[model samples]
Target chain A: MMKSRSRWVYMLLMLLIGAFHILPFYLLFTTSFKPIDDLSSKWVLPETWNPDNFKNAWEQANMGSAFINNLVITAISLVFVVILGALAGYPLARVQTRLNKWVYNLFVSAMVVPPLTILVPLYKLVADLGGMNTYWAVILLHVTFQLPLSIFLFTGFIQTIPRELEEAAMVDGASRLGLFFRIIFPLLKPITATVMILTGIGVWNDYQFSVFFLQSSESQTLTVALSTFFSQYVSNVGWVAAGSLLSALPPIVLFLFLQKYFIRGLASGAVKG
Target chain B: MEVGGVLNREKQTERLAGMVGRNKRLHPSAWLNLLYVPALVLFAVFILYPFFKGIQVSFTNWDGYSQTFSWIGLDNYRRMINDPNIGTVIENTLIYGVCSTVFQNIIGLAYALLLNQSVKGRGIVRTIVYLPVIVSPLIMGYIWYFFFQLQGGALNDVVQLFGNQPVNFLDDPKWNVWIITFVNTYQYVGIAMVIYMAGLQSISKEYYEAAELDGASGRQRFWHITLPLLMPAITVNIVLNLIGGLKLFDVIMALTKGGPGYASQSISTMMFKVYFASQDAGYAAALGNLMFVLISVFSLVALTYLRRREVA
Candidate 1:
């Protein structure tokens, strides 16, 4: 085939694929803008756009509180995962010991195991520890699950950082802490960016853990809140659609801001590494 | 030979001396070992503890709340063996998992190849195509369910335009499985696409050019060069999808709740029902244990055998 024709063919195929991807979002966006009276109508295009649904859904869902709760939990989880993950990864990557190797395997193996397998017992354990219905409880759970993946990825990335830099730092009488904080950590910006974006998306979107762990409305994240909305009013397409669009906005914004790093991180996590 | 032996002896002695000096200087590493204590303790308390506690709680006649119950060892596991509901759930989970994994990978690979072609607007398409994968599955469930709503569903509406009967994709067990698989593929194909695209990008164009020089056609080039080169990504995608399919809960929970008489439930969903909703903590633990074993065995087998084929 000629180059020009191939380009057209490729763009056409991509447009078809884009249609599948865009349709659901289009449905969601359009439905969210529908008037309450026209909510049931399957209009391909909204006859009249209604912005009131957003205000109503936000007020009814108390999404302001949910948004705050989600921010707190995700921010805390991301901070810990990045800081501790880097710390843990540095030594685990540099230290050549039998125990560290075993620990590395243990962490990697945790990835394949489903969180649901341990959910019931985890509920009991948290209740016993008086952590139920608390933001910290959900935050802690998120950190635990996210740690292994971050630590593994960081360790792999850290391996590619040459030891000569650290050796030179040591020659300058820099302490191990100094060498890490000053040299290694700064060198890990790309990997750190990758981890932040990757884990950020995950913690933000997590529902199973958030739903099961967070008991009260006060501590609910966007996903669990949206899920509970579905159960309470299954037929209210306007409210559901409005709530979904609101819930999707933050993550979509996040992905857009970090699109380059997001793709890089995903490539490493899913393909490169 | 004598000179080589003498050099080796000198090197060995030097290595020992360096190790001793390093050991004396690295006393802080022993203290640094305590760094893992927090993570390890958290893992044990949250993950390991819950895993084992489920086993202990399962063998009891406890109602999940009270602190007073007697041991009923082997009873819950025994009951599960004869529970006919468990059979249907197992069948549903396996079929859903296998079908989704196989087809998701195929579709994802196809998209990856298409996206890899040098074309204008590729970046925008990649961004748009990935939008679905990033959405929460429960939300996707609601959206897709609307599109499958018999009379008014977009799917049916389109089908009707072609003069066909509207199918209830989410109601019938047979159709529900297909619908569930479709949703999973829709949600995950983007991930597979991105990963496969990364794999594709890693391959040098020189290989394709060389293949073309030898009079190889598109199909032949793909068969001889692309598939083998993409094996690493294939294994990764397959394992991820398999594990993901097996553990799927939100979509199934949101869409059907293992409904139409337990026709769409997965092992994970079954565990949820028995443990939380149905109040069978002990039996649920047994199911959880079964999942643990199944996942571990499959992962280990894949890592040991399949991963060996990836190029270093």
Candidate 2:
């Protein structure tokens, strides 16, 4: 009887904490659907459900184009980071040479160094290279900053796979590149998934890089677009709430689909760091 | 057979080396070098060169626009020392860092302990708690902005339920920093909890059983067994929170914009203003360099201290 009583207390406590986390999301979604008249008075639910707020947000924020820009940048950056990260990580994991060890350490150290420290000069370099306001510029920067962690994760992962397959394949007259593609690359699916979720969300949700690098309205990513939208519509609560929800949907949906890998990825990354 | 296969491959590599007219025996594949070239070039051009270039820029009088500006040694650093806003920025940053780290660890550990128990609906609870972590901080900040609004905000509505006057949470300077810290802690405690849960799982069940057998209380067992064993998670959590809090930009940008007249400005936000708003790139670089040094020193000190505790 005492044990059951204590379990109820625990359940109540957990429920309270869960409610604290969910309350803002509740407010956001409900507020988005609220009409302007209901926004300042109603807290729990909208008096009249208004779906047009999303349309207003999408059109006014220029989020339609912003979403496409973000999708392109994030997709291109993720592909490059995964492929290049795997290529670089494979050598670091397999080779015992002094150069490889030094290179691996360099990448690891880069992970802790704040990327903002180099933002000024990087901006200058990008401008000099005529990369400002271009997708390739932000794509390259994302790939670069995201590379260190991706490489670290891939290297740690690849170290666990046995090398006998590669060696045997090499002895069977398979070329090294062919061996990697046929044998090693396919084996990297799990880590690739982890890297993709980790770095994909990072690039998609990045604000600092996008704000600094992409200056044009046409080039603005979803995050920048949303921030600009909020400032412009600061007085209109319903529209701003709708904008926030739309801005948050992609990553939240992705997280829901890949929830298991997301937790494991964060845990492993934290443990390793 | 494995050893013979390796030797045979070495011999074939040597034969290939001879055929290529190179004296060195190729053990590691040359294709590996080719694979690393792109990563190396990207790192060199984007990361390596820019870091050194930033250091050089910090000493200059360049306004970020002019192509030609003479180097002025230590001038920007000296100005940073004398700048009145520097003190507030540093103090706010330190408070944010220390408070966020403390709260995140304590709250996260509590949640981890609860979840570690055999609770029903553990999976659902964990998912809900960690959901905010996956959401972008920019949006999280805006979400909380609505919550903290005076007239129709959720927080104000809750306050009114108790017959209390609505507090202006964001606009008031006194409560602004704390509110920011709270929001930061809210978003990130899940990460700390997940990490602590991982740490807790690694502790053997026998330790607790042994402690119970020795008649040690739950509190004693926690301090003696659990806390000591959880040092690694503690280290990671503290360092991450400290660095994250110190370099906080997005949430502050979305929520406050370092507003109410720079009362809640952090070093990063201040640096952004100096560079873009003030057009003083050299000074901003100096500030960024100072932040770099501060982060490096703090991380190193915290790591060493926490690691020593783990050993002891």
Candidate 3:
């Protein structure tokens, strides 16, 4: 252990690091609350703590509709991700057939392919499908891209579950699929949470594909809506700030509540995969 | 962790599947593999198809939206090689990819080490560092945007207090890419820290205890014990950051939009400009392919090189 006198230095450094990390956020806090007329520097807190920025940004940015679109897309994408990712991971993890191995590799390799690399044709494909402004188009894209990591995580997690559970279930005359539903699905909750957290956040905060696919004002998600708002009101720093803050509120709130799961899920799902 | 599972996973799965009764009659379990059909179809339609189509489109003379275009046959690729703006774009991409990786890893490792100590307020500090990572990168960039914007910006205000001119951090070519990298590094270093912390915890305290008994200096113990043992974590972080930073689009779009006239254009952002604004979908597709290769090669090489060191 470090000496008591020097330990204070380390603790001080820790607090300094915390302050350093929180600087942008603190600035965001002040800027978002301030009115556009306030000529104060970003370092200063709002003079009167105007709530108009929030109201204006919310209305101008259509934050309500964007929030709903984000929710619908993220929630639906997550459902497909869990169902397809977990189901695919089961055979890939347990069966280990040559075909299964190839399929698993195929799924995992897609993780490295930056989705933007294919944006040129993907955009055209979506447009051709009449999916240009549709939620399903973006939802499917999110589900597809997110599946690789989800499958990878689910496969890795499933491998660790003991075989005895399945073996015992088999002795009681449970079919493989039946046993999967009965035994394996329940054990998947922990890893599923990790998958959901990791993939759900990725889908929720998505901009790359969404920016391309979800172009209409009616279909825009939070990030898209914020970008549209920022470009339209390029000088409305206050409104932009407010919209940015509002859009980011959901995941930030979620992370705060599930801090343990968030950290652990990232560590296990990403690094291990 | 399961990168090392390759050797044992076979025997384990075999034993498990053997007991589960490997059906000899047409392998009934093979039907189970059909569960992935929907996923495979989605991948083929969305990813696999577009990926190949992008490569095909790169060779054509198609504007982003049109029914008629000639097959230019490598003209777009050739143009990319000679394009005036591309040199800066690629350089910026590297700075985003390679430089951000360096900063994130070094800073993250330091934070991990500091937090690994029995320090007060470590947990809260860890949370603060990681909070930015969950926020959208666009919003994170915008947050920093308020701090660095020239007029009435926080940094400028501090400069004025000191009676100095506020530098244009985001607009200057010299500083634009670096600032973008910095913001990105700020957003993601938490992930690296958390990974490194996990690695550090997994390292046995007995190693440090024995090193202390041997009168090894703290520096020597760290270099000899900690760094080597943390190679796995290092590998994961490098590949992750490299891939992430190379494909960085949102932050650059949010911060400078790859501008003050292409000063900070990365391959990702530049591709967006070419495809949408310039309407040069063919050239954008070519750049897209270049990025694909660049990301694949960099991450693959890093993975291989780091994975080797981990075994050693």
TM-scores vs. true structure, each candidate: 0.93, 0.94, 0.95
Query: What overall lDDT, based on C-alpha atoms, would model 3 receive against the true structure?
Result: 0.89
Each prediction's DockQ against the real complex: 0.49, 0.57, 0.60
Give me the displacement of residue B115 in model 2, in angstroms.
Answer: 0.9
Off by over 4 Å in 2: A39-42, B1-27, B160-165
Off by over 4 Å in 1: A39-43, B1-30, B159-166
User: Which of 1 and 3 is the better model by lDDT?
Assistant: 3
Rank order (by DockQ, best first) = 3, 2, 1
lDDT of 3 by residue, B1-312 (tens): 473344244335544556444445434456667778888999999999999999999999899888999999989988998999889889999999999999999999999999988876899999999999999998888888888888777888998899999888889998888899999999999999999999899899999999999999989999999999999999999999999999999999899999999899999998999999999999999999999999999999999999999845
The TM-score between candidate 3 and the true structure equals: 0.95
On DockQ, the candidate that comes out on top is 3
Which one is best on lDDT? Answer: 3
lDDT of each: 0.80, 0.86, 0.89
Which lDDT tens digits does candidate 3 get at residues A1-273?
469868988978987899999998889888888887898888888889998999999999998999999999999999999999999898888876677789999998898999999989999999899998898888888999999998899889889999888877666655677678889999999898988998878988989988998888999999999988998987878899889988899899999999999999888765674
Sorted by lDDT (best first), the order is 3, 2, 1
Ranked by TM-score, the better of candidates 1 and 3 is: 3
